[model samples]
Target: MTIEQRYQLAKAQYESWGIDVDAALAKLKQVPISIHCWQGDDVGGFEVNKQALSGGIDVTGNYPGKATTPEELRQDIEQALKLIPGQHRINLHAIYAETNGEIVERDQLKPHHFQNWIDWAKKHQLGIDFNPTLFSHPKADDGLTLSHPDQSIRDFWIRHCQASRRIAEHIGKELGSPVLTNIWIPDGYKDTPSDRLGPRKRLKESLDTIFSEEIDSTYNLDAVESKLFGIGSEAYVVGSHEFYLGYAVQNNKLCLLDTGHYHPTEMVSNKISALLLFSDKVALHVSRPVRWDSDHVVSFDDELKEIGLEIVRNDALNNVLIGLDFFDASINRVAAWTIGTRNMIKALLYALLMPNDQLKVYQEQGDYTKRLAVLEEFKSYPFGAVWDYYCERMDVPAGLDWLDHVNKYEDDVLVKRANKS
Candidate 1:
C-alpha cells in the first residue's frame, strides 16, 4: 500500500482514541536530537596530541571507515542526518578543536579553533552543543580531573572547563541559540577509597571556580553528569548521582543523566517527573549499556519507549534536553547513528500516539485493570504506519529503504577512505 494510505488508516485509529497523530508528528519534528560527533570517529577527536580513550569510558570496534578529520566527521553527520526525520543539533567535545596542527592546550582552546565548525554549522543550519573533554589527557591520566588531590591539576582542569564554557558561549552566539555545555569527568578510584570526601570537596570547589566566570544563559547552558562507576572508577565515583543532583540543585545547573550510568533496575524515566518539580530543565545522555556502562547502540527497547512516554506524558517536552551519547563502531558507523537516532524518535512517536490523557485519567480514577489492558493492546497498534509516513514526509527513506543509501555511501565514500588509511 502507499505510505499515505497506510498513514491515513493509522491516523484514524489514533484519532479514535482522541490522540492527534498529526499534532504528534508535528511536535516530534520540532524536537531536535543532539547527535554526538564522536560516534563518527570512535571518539578519536582531531587533536594533535591525542591520547588513548580513558575516563572510565571506552569505545570498542575497529570500523574501517571512521572519519579521521573534522571535515569527514561533519560530512558523516550530514549523511546520518539525511536519513533521520528531524532538525537536529551537533554535540562536540573540546578535543574535536582544530588547531591547524599547532599544540593548543585544553585550557587555552579558543573559539577560533572551532571557526570552521561554526561556519559549517551555519551552512547546515544546525545548532551546536559543547562538552569539555575531561578524560584521556595527561592531567586526567590518573583518572582524576576536577577532583584531583593536587592543587595544580585541579586548577588546570578548572581553567579548561572555564575555557570550554566560554567557547560554547561563542558558538551559541554565532548559531543564535543557547548551547548546552555539559561537563562529565571520570574522577574516581579503581578500588575503595578512604578519603572520598576530599575528592568531592575539591570537585565542588573546582566547579565553583569554573562557573565563576558567568556568561549569559541566553548563549550557553551548563550541566553536570553523574556515573555509577567506570573502568577506573569501579569502587567509587566522586560525582555520584547524589553529588551532582545536590550540586545542580543548589548551583542551579542542569543535572545531566546518562541512561547507562545508573544501576540496571533504576529508570531515568522515573527521575524525570521528580526533577521537573524542582528544576526548570533536565539534560539526558541516551545510551544503551550491556552489563556495565558499555555504551552500546540504542535499541527501541521497552525502557526507551518508557523514557519517551515520561517526557511526553509529563508535558516536559521543552524542559527535557535530549541528546544521543552511544558510540558503537562495530557496525557501519553511519548506520549505527541512523539506527540509534531513528529508534529514539520512534519511541517518542510511539508515546505521542498513545492516549496519554485517558491513561492518566484511568490511573487517577484507580482503573488499573483497564489501564494495563489498554496499554498492552495499544502496543500492537499501527505505530509503524505513522512512523513510515513520518520518514516519507520528511523526504528520508521509510522502513528499510534507508539501508540502501547507507550501503551505497559506505561503498562510495567510506571504502575509499579505508583504502587510503
Candidate 2:
C-alpha cells in the first residue's frame, strides 16, 4: 500500500477507539527535546586548561573524527539536527564555553564567554540549556566538588554553579525562553565513609549559597540532579535520590532524573508521577544503561516508551522537561546524536498514538480483563505509519532514508577530519 493509504487506515483505526490522531501529532510537535552537546565531542570541551575526564565518569573508545573545536562540534550538531523529526534545544556544559584563546577559570566565567554560542543558537532559532561542569577539573580530582571537605574547594564549585545560573539566565533572556540550569555534582566516596552527614550538610549549605541569588523564572529555572552511584563512588553517593528529591521540594527547584543514575532495576518512568505531585517541574536525562551507568545511545526500547507514556498519560508534557544524555565514542558521533534523538522522538510519537483515555477508563471501571486485552491489542497498531507521516510533515527524511544523509555527511565531513589529522 502507498504511505497515504497506510496512514488513512491507521487514522480510521485510531478514530474508532475515540483517539484524535491529528491532535496527538500536534502535541508531539510542540514538545521539544533538549539534545546534549557532549555527544558530538565525546564530552571533550574546548577550554584553555582542558583536563582529562575524571570524577567517576569517562567516555569509552577513541572514535576518529571526534569534534575537537567549537566550530566543528556546531557543524556536527547542525548535521544531526537536520535529520531529527521535531524542534529541539541544545544543552551545553560550562566546559564548552569559547574563550577566544583567553584563560577563563570556571568560577570567573561570564555571559560573554558564551556569546558565540548564544549567537549561533539564535541563528538556528534554538533554545539553550546550561549545566555546571562540576567534574574533570583539578579541584574535583578527589571525587568531590560542592561536598568537598576543604572549604576553599567547596567555595570554588559554589561560585562556578552560581556563574552557570547567570549564564543560563543570559541565554534565556537573549533567546526569549527559560533556560534550564541543571547542577549535577560528582561528590561521593568509593568506600563507606566515617562521616556521611558531614558531606551532605556541606552540600546542602553549598547549594543554598549557589541559589541565594534569585533570577527571574522567565529567564532561568534551577534543577538539582542526583545519582545512585558512579564508577568510583559505588559505596556511597552524597547526593542520593532521596536527598535531591527533598532538596528540590524544599527549595522549589526542579529535580533531574537521569535514567542511568538510578539502580539497575529502577526505571525512571515510575518516579515521574510521584515527583510531579510535589514539584512543579521535573527534568529528565534520557539515556540507556547496560546493567550499569554506561551512557549508551538511547533506543526505542520498552523503558523509553514507558517514559514517554508516563508524560503523555499524565498530561504533563509542559511540566516534564525532556533531554538526551549519552556519550558513545565507539560509533560515529553524528550518527549517535541523530539515532538517539530520532528514537527519542519516535518513543514520544508512540505514546501520543496510544489510546490513553480508553485505557484509563478501563482501569477506573475495574475492567482489568478489558484493559489487558486492549493494551495487548494496542501493540499491533499501525504506529509506524503514523510516525512516517509525522516525519514527512516535519520535512525530514522518514524511515531509514535519514541514514543516507548521515552517511553522506560522514563521507564529506567527518572522514576528512581523520585524513587531515
Candidate 3:
C-alpha cells in the first residue's frame, strides 16, 4: 500500500486501541522536529570507572579518553547524520581537556583549537550547541564556586568568565549559529550552606563583567540563558545566582530548559513559561531525572505527557531547540544513540497528537486531570501508530527498530541474571 493509505489504516488502528485517534494521527503527520546529538566528552582518553577503569564512559567518572582524532570525529558525525537525518547537531566544548580535575590557566582560551573544530563541523554540515561557562573546565582550579572566600580564587573565576566571552564570540561567528552557552556551575553547598549572599553576588559580579564588557561587542550575542538550581541532597545553587546570570545577560538570549537540573518538586512548564516570557528563542535539553542525579536517560514520556501537550498547544513549541542529554556504557555508544533518538521521536509525536484548542482549555481552566487524560489516551494508542507514522514520515536510521532494540536489551539482562544465579 502507498504511504498515505498506510497512514489512514494506522489511524484507524490507533482509534481502535482506545487512544484519541483523530488528534494522535494529526500529531503524527506534522513536520518532525530536528534532533541534536550531544557529542559527549572525547571518547579517546582513558575511561576511569571507579579507580582507573577502562570499561566505558558511564555515569560515575568524568573522564572520556581520546579515541577519535579530529578526522575520525568528523567521520563519525557524518555517519550518524546519514544514519539519522534532519538538522542534526552535537554540543561542542571550546576548551579541550579543560575539565579533567586539573589545575591550569583560567585567564585564557585557545582560539586556534576552537577555530579548527568549528571548521571541521562546518565541513560536515553539522551544527554545534556550545556549552560555555562550564565550571568543570580546567581553569576553574580554585573552583567557580563563589563560596571560595580567597581573593585569588575569586579572581580566577572572574578571569574565566572573561575568557568564556571571547571564546563564545569567536566560535559563534565561525559556526554561524546562535551559540547556546549552557551555564551549569558545580558550585553549590557541599555540606551546610556557605555565605550564600556574598558568594552569589561575587559570581554575578563575575558574570556581569562578561555580559556587559566581554565579547567583541558587535558579535551576535544569542546567549542561551541556562542555570542549575540545586545539586544532590540539601545543596542549592540559589536564585540570586541563577536569576542574576539568566536575567542580567542581554535579551534575545534563549533559555535552556534542562530536565534534570532543577529541584525535584519544581514544575517544568513553569520553567518553560518563564523563559518563554523573556526570550522568543527557547531551547531544551531533554533527559530523565534520576534521584539526586541527572541520569541522562531516555526520559519516560509518561512523565511530561500532559504538560508537554499544553506547552505545544499554547504555540510554545515553534522556536524551541530540543536536544537529547544522554549517556550509556562508553562501549554501548551505539545503543545509547539509538534509544535516545527513539525517545526524542516519541516526545515529538506526543506533542503533535495533542489538540491545540482542547489543551488550551485545560490550561485555561486548570483542569490538569483533563489534560492528563489526553496524554494517557495517546499512550494507549496502538503500538505501531508511532512506528508507522514516524518511520514513514521522517528520516530515521534505516535498520534501527525500537522494539527490536528493547527485546535485545531484555535478552541480555536475562542472560546476565542467569549467569549470576
lDDT on C-alpha atoms for all candidate structures: 0.94, 0.92, 0.51
Where's the lowest-lDDT run of ten residues in candidate 1? 54-63
After superposition, the stretches of candidate 2 with alpha carbons farther than 4 Å from their true spots are none
For candidate 1, report its TM-score: 0.99
| lDDT (Cα, tens digit) per residue for candidate 3, span 337-375 | 555655565555566554556656787999999888875
- Candidate 3: segments with Cα more than 4 A from true spot: 1-5, 11-58, 61-68, 97-106, 136-147, 214-234, 238-253, 304-311, 362-375, 382-389, 402-421
Better of 1 and 2 by lDDT: 1
For residues 1-421, could you state the per-residue lDDT of candidate 2 as single tens digits? 8777889999999889888999999999999999999999888898998999987777998888989899999999999988887788999999999999998999999999999999999999899999999999999998999999899999999999999999999999999999999999889988988998999999999999999998889999999999999988999999999999999999999999999999999989999999999988899999999978889999999999999999999999999999999999999898899899989988888888888988999999999999999888998899999988888889988889988998899899889998888
lDDT of 2: 0.92
Better model by TM-score, 1 or 3? 1
The residue pairs in collision within model 3 are 27-352, 27-353, 43-65, 44-65, 44-66, 44-67, 45-65, 45-66, 46-65, 98-138
Which stretches of model 1 miss by more than 4 angstroms? none
